[model samples]
Target chain A: MIELVLSFLKLGAVSYGGGWTIVGLIRTEVLRQGWLDEGAFRDLVAIAQVTPGPVALNAATLVGHKVGGLAGSALATLSVVTVPILASLALGALISRLGPRGNRFREALRSGTFGLLAMTVWAFAPEAARDPFAAGLALGAFGLAAFTKANPVLLILGAGALKLLASFVLA
Target chain B: MQASKPPSPLRLFLFFARISAVTLGGGYVLVPVIARGLERKGWMEEKDFFSLFGAAQSLPGPIGLNAALFAGRALAGLPGLFASALGVLVPPFAAILLVSEAIGVVAAQKQARAFLDGAFAVVPGLVAALLWRMIRTRAWNPGRVVLALAAAAAMILAPGWAPAFFFAAAALGWFVETPGTKA
Candidate 1:
């Protein structure tokens, strides 16, 4: 439990850029610590995405729940947000002082965040490659989400429904 | 309907709670909804909210959550800050707990596994799309492109050591982008 909370705390501290950026970090940490199997973790990320919050925060809470139960969930949620709240409270005034360099700082952070996203995409590539139907859905999802304004929730549910239908047909 | 006075902490709590509960699609989608809602209530103008949101983006955590904290504090001080924090957090916590509990039951069913497998499959594609957008949006200099690719390669190689690589990228970007700042 303590280790679980500790990991979230550390991840929360470096979780600059946004939720997506920190997601890859969470994946690496959880996988490295042997907390969840790959398939389970992948499912968890899917759940986290469709849920109504930050993906990273949802992932943290769910991972905590799985790893340490209800008490773990509460503590992990608190732990993940602790640093950001503290930083927000403490450095609320610092951004203004950053001047033009602030843009540079943000751009710099972007360079790192891009890598984080790349790692995430890389890590999950195998899941997309698991089957032909899965690959098609993945490509379809990328096309719609990347090129159009289709809601991701719809995409997720649509894929699930299609897969379920296929399961029934194939069975 | 203009709010003549800043919202009380409890009011702020309810306000944020309501938004967090109904808003979906994570930070990018949530932030705009919040800004519009605040505007609609006359609690904060979109301009003021977005400027504060700009500050919020500079911090870590989800932009939606951070924006709430900043807006709450700006409107109603320390009490509002904590209240807003709770508001943003509590709904999702409840929602996820319910879903996880439900999932644990259905997970044993064959259909459920297939659906979940399909749902999970889109993740890589979704993330890849996100990366594509990031790549398109950035004002990428050649040097920055090289740096980002190098950093990506390193992080992919050593996922466990991602934090170090991230910091190294940030520091290098900071230094290399502006030679005039320190000198």
Candidate 2:
């Protein structure tokens, strides 16, 4: 239990850029620690996606549960959030103290985040590239999301439905 | 109709809980949803909300969780922070636990596999759209674009060096983008 808390605590602190990068970090840690195999990790990512809230939190909770049941889940969730809470408070203080000049720091972080997000796209590109149909579907989704105010949840569900329908027809 | 009276801790907690329960696609998506919710509730003004959001983004950890903490702290101090964080966390915590237990059964079917594969494939696009939105909101400058490209290249070429890359970018951004620096 202590180990679980400590591991996630470390991850929570360094898991910058959020989103997919955090997911990748969790995947690496879990695999390295022998807490979950690759298949289970994949399922966790999928589950994290369809469910609400931050994927990193969801993944941490699931991992905690897998490792140490209810207690583990509680601890892991707390561990993952502890640093973020403190960091936000600190950043808030810094912003108030520095005023407009602080804006540069935020901009820099945002720039770095853009890069990290691009890496996320790069990481996932191979999966889409494996199948031409999947690639086309992804491109279409990108266009819709970029141009329209469509709900992302619906877009994801719609893609799933299309895939199911296509598989049925083709098979 | 903005309420003159301050919101109770319970109200603050419930507000975030409701947001966390319904909003999807992760932290980035929550920005607008949260802004709208807070605006409608009159708990915060627009400028304050964005400032808080910017701080949340700049800080390490999950953006959604960080936002919740900031919102809670801003509203009711320490107790409010605990209340809001708990409220926002419980739903996802419960949902993930349930899903993790049931995933084995659900993932076994062929159709489920195909559906998940398809949904997963769209994630990159979703993220890309998010990046595009971020870029659009910012001033287009050579330095910013160059830094972003460098970080992305490092991330791809050497996955293990992500933390170092992010730190380097942050340092460079501080130096190059800071006030009084030559454009």
Top-DockQ candidate index: 1
Compared with the true structure, what per-residue lDDT tens digits does model 1 show for residues A94-162? 775677777777767667778888898888878767899999889999999999988877888898889
Instruction: Please give the distance, in angstroms, between residue A148's alpha carbon in candidate 2 and its true position after superposition.
Output: 2.5
Model 2 spans > 4 angstroms off? A1-7, A14-21, A31-39, B180-183
**Per-residue lDDT for A143 in model 1?**
96
Candidate 1 at residue B59, lDDT? 82
Model 2 lDDT per residue over A40-84, tens place: 776676677789998788889989999998889989999988887
Deviation in angstroms for B88 in model 1?
0.9
The whole-model lDDT of each prediction reads 0.84, 0.77
B167 Cα displacement, candidate 2 (Å): 1.5
Docking class of 1: medium
Candidate 1: which pairs clash?
A: none
Ten-residue segment with the worst summed lDDT in candidate 2 chain A? A19-28
Best by lDDT: 1
* Weakest lDDT window of 10 consecutive positions for candidate 1 chain B: B174-183
